[model samples]
Target: MKQQTKQEILYRFPDGFWWGSATSATQIEGAANEGGKGPNIWDYWYEKEPNRFFNGVGPSVTSDFYHRYKEDIALMKEIGHNSFRLSISWSRLIPGGIGDVNPTAVQFYNNVINELLENEIEPFVTLFHFDMPLAMQELGGWESRDVVDAYARYAKICFELFGDRVKKWFTHNEPIVPVEGGYLYDFHYPNIIDFQRAVQVAYHTIIAHAKAVQVFKQMNIPDGKIGIILNLTPSYPRSSHPADVKAAHIADLFFNRSFLDPAVKGEYPQDLVDLLREYGYLPVTKEGDQKLIKENTVDILGINYYQPRRVKTKEHLPNPEAPFMPDRFFDYYAMPGRKMNPHRGWEIYEKGIYDILMNVKENYGNIECFISENGMGVEGEERFRDEDGMIHDDYRIEFIREHLKWVHKAIQEGANVKGYHVWTFMDNWSWTNAYKNRYGLVAVDLENNRKRTIKKSGYWFKTLVENNGF
Candidate 1:
């Protein structure tokens, strides 16, 4: 096969396109017990059951951003990152999740924010990224209405502290992940396998998002934009059969619309509500929740597209005794002949990014959006090292380039997308998966006291971001 030149690339994004990476506190900041940081649910969970994590790794052994943020920010500048996204650990700020603030943690975050600004890097800060304080979880987590108010208080505190420097603020990162991981999928802390509780958790999360938006608006911070990050998995049916189509629709309703509708459209899908009602799984809501959601929808949306969901008609009859499962009406189908991310076991469909953008444009009113987290994860990446200490990450480069093409096409078609940020800045400890999959432009050498080395993809991304296109 003949090689194609860069000029022959099909899609090119607009000028000033943001190209950076994302990381969360618990994933990268390893000072879990230091700087007056209280134990989050993850810390407590890992302590109780270290075996639950991959390789027995936990948050306490993250990239140590708390100590190395300055060096990391320098690397970000070197890699041509004009902007970056990170989250503030709520537990770090307020140890009990609702009381007095931690002065040391506050100073630490202030230093990080200021350093990023000094380096001319735009900081997109998210308020939450699944690291709830154990104290808060003890109060029933997202299942309690009071916890929503507590979250608002936490968001307000962050706004007051960081809003002056951080222009872009996100309320939550992939809110549905916690509901699924914690309440249904049993991957996150406080893991439960109850569908009713899952629905309630999802419901309360939306309410919390709306309440945070309300708080943000009330704060009157200049140039501030508050939004929620969603990991949207575009659902595709197996065929044109009505049953297959219906299955796809329900899948979309459960995974996509459950949060998308409320965050963007300010109302849950009627079908979802009906399904919950039929099964008596509807979460309790206050009188003013609908109005609050409608009046205070997100100013922007962060789209994190890693895969697509292909669905078909259910293979088996629904279990009557099972408490309200979303997959009861559909079956997940692995499309044969589809490309796959072998390391992560996710189908790598580039067009899924376009579909997600189009859905936001057509159905969700084209709310301001960006690719918040999209990247490939690899297992045991150290095997690719060479004599020069560089890892040839061409696979990651191809993954990003293909996805950026779709994002570019969507923007050209008026999708209102602003930028793209990969899943991570460097390899960090994921909750339970815990360093099993590395998704980073710069690899961290864990054995060498957590040394950072820029991979080949880092050099490639520097040029891509500097050029604003590939």
Candidate 2:
């Protein structure tokens, strides 16, 4: 085989391309219960079953961003970061998720936002990041329509509190992850396996997003944009057979179109609605929901693409007696000769990002978008020790370079992409997986007072951002 050189990469992004890193409050901020922060779902869940987490680690012992944010921001500026994305915990703001505001938490967030702006770094703030307040979860969570209203109110409070400094606001992060992890996979809190409940939860989340957008519009905040972050997984057929094609289409509808259409177009896809009606799994909707959704679509989009789905027709027939299942119509097929992430067992196909951008451009009106979260996750990464007590993560550098090449290609082909933010800034506690998978340019040492060290990828990313491409 012939070799392709770096100059062979044909595309370059526009001037002022945003190159930064992202992290959630609950994942990186270790002051879990301090500063008037009440219990979130993660805190409550960990208290119940500590063994469920990897290495028995929980959010209480995270990257310690609460105390080290000033130093971290300095590092961000030193590494050529012009922007950073972070989330505000709902329970931290409103302990009961609905009642009075917490003064200490308010001051802390204001300080963080003001500090970011003072340092000339744009802050992208997300409202909810899979950390539902325990009080709200007890009230039927997303399964009840009332929770949707509560979420909208919470979002409005955030806008009123932080909209002056935070120009870009995201309603939710990976909305479908809760439906799959909390409802189907039994990996998250309130774990259950009911497709009907899952459909309802998904529906309510869309409603919450629409309501939040409506509130934002009502506020009329100048030069501010509100959007939702979606994890778009492009689907590919195993073969050209009619069954395989149909399976791929259905999978795409379920995974991508289910949330993308409503967030972008203000309406769900007709095919997805038809499938739900056929299976009697359609979520109950109230009056005016259709109009609300149609009127308040997102002003921007955040795409988080990690991998694609290779699907084939299901070999087994549907069982009438069993509860509804999404995989009943299609089966996942592991592609032969596909590149793999040895540390995390995930497929690495750089083209998936390009295909995702193209799909959004062709089918979703080419909305303004950016890569919200993309990175390689490694398990037990501490074993890669060196004489200097630093991890030489060259593989991570290669992973990001391959993905950026595809993103650059998509931008050249007129895909309306604006920026790229890696999944994290430093290794922190993941929700259920805890600290097992490290997806960060900066490594955090959990021992010896939670120290942070820049990895090789961090240096590479700094130069890439400085040059706008490398």
Best by lDDT: 1
Against the unseen true structure, what C-alpha lDDT does each candidate score?
0.90, 0.89
lDDT of 2 by residue, 65-88 (tens): 888889888888777788999999
Where does the lowest 10-residue lDDT sum fall in candidate 2? 1-10
User: For model 1, where is the 10-residue window of minimal lDDT?
Assistant: 1-10
Q: Estimate each model's TM-score.
A: 0.97, 0.97
Q: In angstroms, what RMSD does candidate 1 have relative to the true structure? A: 2.1
**Per-residue accuracy of model 1 over 58-141 as CA lDDT, tens digit each:** 888599999999999999999999899999999999999999999998899999999998998999999999999999999999
